[model samples]
Target: MAWDTEATKQKLLNAAIDEFAERGFAGARIQEIAKKSGCNRERIYFYFDNKIGLFEAALVQQLVTALDDVPVRGTGPEAVADFAGRYFDFSTTRTALARLTVWEGLERGYPVGAEQRALRSTGKVAEIQNALPSATMREAEDLLLTIVTLCNAWVSTPNIHLVLTGAPDLQRRRASIVRTSELLAQDTV
Candidate 1:
């Protein structure tokens, strides 16, 4: 029988994402990942080279999904605001990316896939610029950063939200983020 390499790799990556998000890089164990994936430990080494490699791949995969899933449509500050709301919605549903980001910042102290991630970020910044033509490149970049940071923070730091709001009102928070994005876009343009 032929082995399903992609399927196996996806399983491992999914398991790795969950483990790393919950435990961070230092606390995550190969054995736990293997068990969660239901794959032999050898496959992790064969496909990813090591734990660090798997971590990077998992994070990169999530980043790719984030970029591809939420797109900026139309042209104007409204478009930017729409994009921010959609991205926030996406983050709320698939929070592994947010948790993994926090874990990476806390444990690694540096981005894992810096160059490739930067390239993707540049593309997103360009999209923002396209939506708001008058906005400078720096303004667009800062806007994208602000939108992502706000979305990720809401998901990754639920305790903060609870402390401030007295309840987890995701809809309220989402509305605020969308409005803030719109206001920032308007100011930039």
Candidate 2:
């Protein structure tokens, strides 16, 4: 039988994402990932070299997917609001990405995927800058960061989110982001 390396790698990634999201790097087990993936343990080393490598691959892949899946639409304050709304929806609905990010922060002693991540960040900021022509790169980055952080906060720390917001309604939080984005956009517009 011919080996399907890509399929095997994808299986490993799918398993590792759940494991890393649930357990973090320090707590994630290679056996669990292998068992969940139904792939040989050797495949991990062959495909990724080590557990850290798998985590990095899974994290990067998921981040890319999330970014690709959610896009900001339109221009000006309306566009900013749309972008924030889309992000809020993405973070709330497809929650593994946010949890994985939190896990990465806790487990990774040094930065992971810095070069690739910087590129992605640059593109997203540029998209925002384009949508709001009057906004500078710094302003766009700050706005993007703020929107992402605000959107993810609920899923990252539900208890605190509930305590502050008085409820766990994501719609309410999303509305807040849209309003905030519109206000920020107004500054540029």
**What's each prediction's TM-score?**
0.98, 0.95
The C-alpha stretches of model 2 lying farther than 4 A from their native spots are none
Q: Pick out the ten consecutive residues of candidate 1 with the lowest summed lDDT.
A: 161-170
lDDT of 1 by residue, 127-185 (tens): 99999999999999999999999999998989998788898998899999999999999
lDDT of 1: 0.94
Q: How many residue pairs clash per model?
A: 0, 0
Over 1-189, each residue of candidate 2 has an lDDT whose tens digit, in order, gives: 999889999999999999998899999999999999999989999999998889889888877887777776778889988988988888888778888888888779665777787788788888888899989988999998888888877778889976776867767778888999889888877
Stretches of model 1 off by over 4 angstroms after superposition: none
Clashing pairs in 1: none
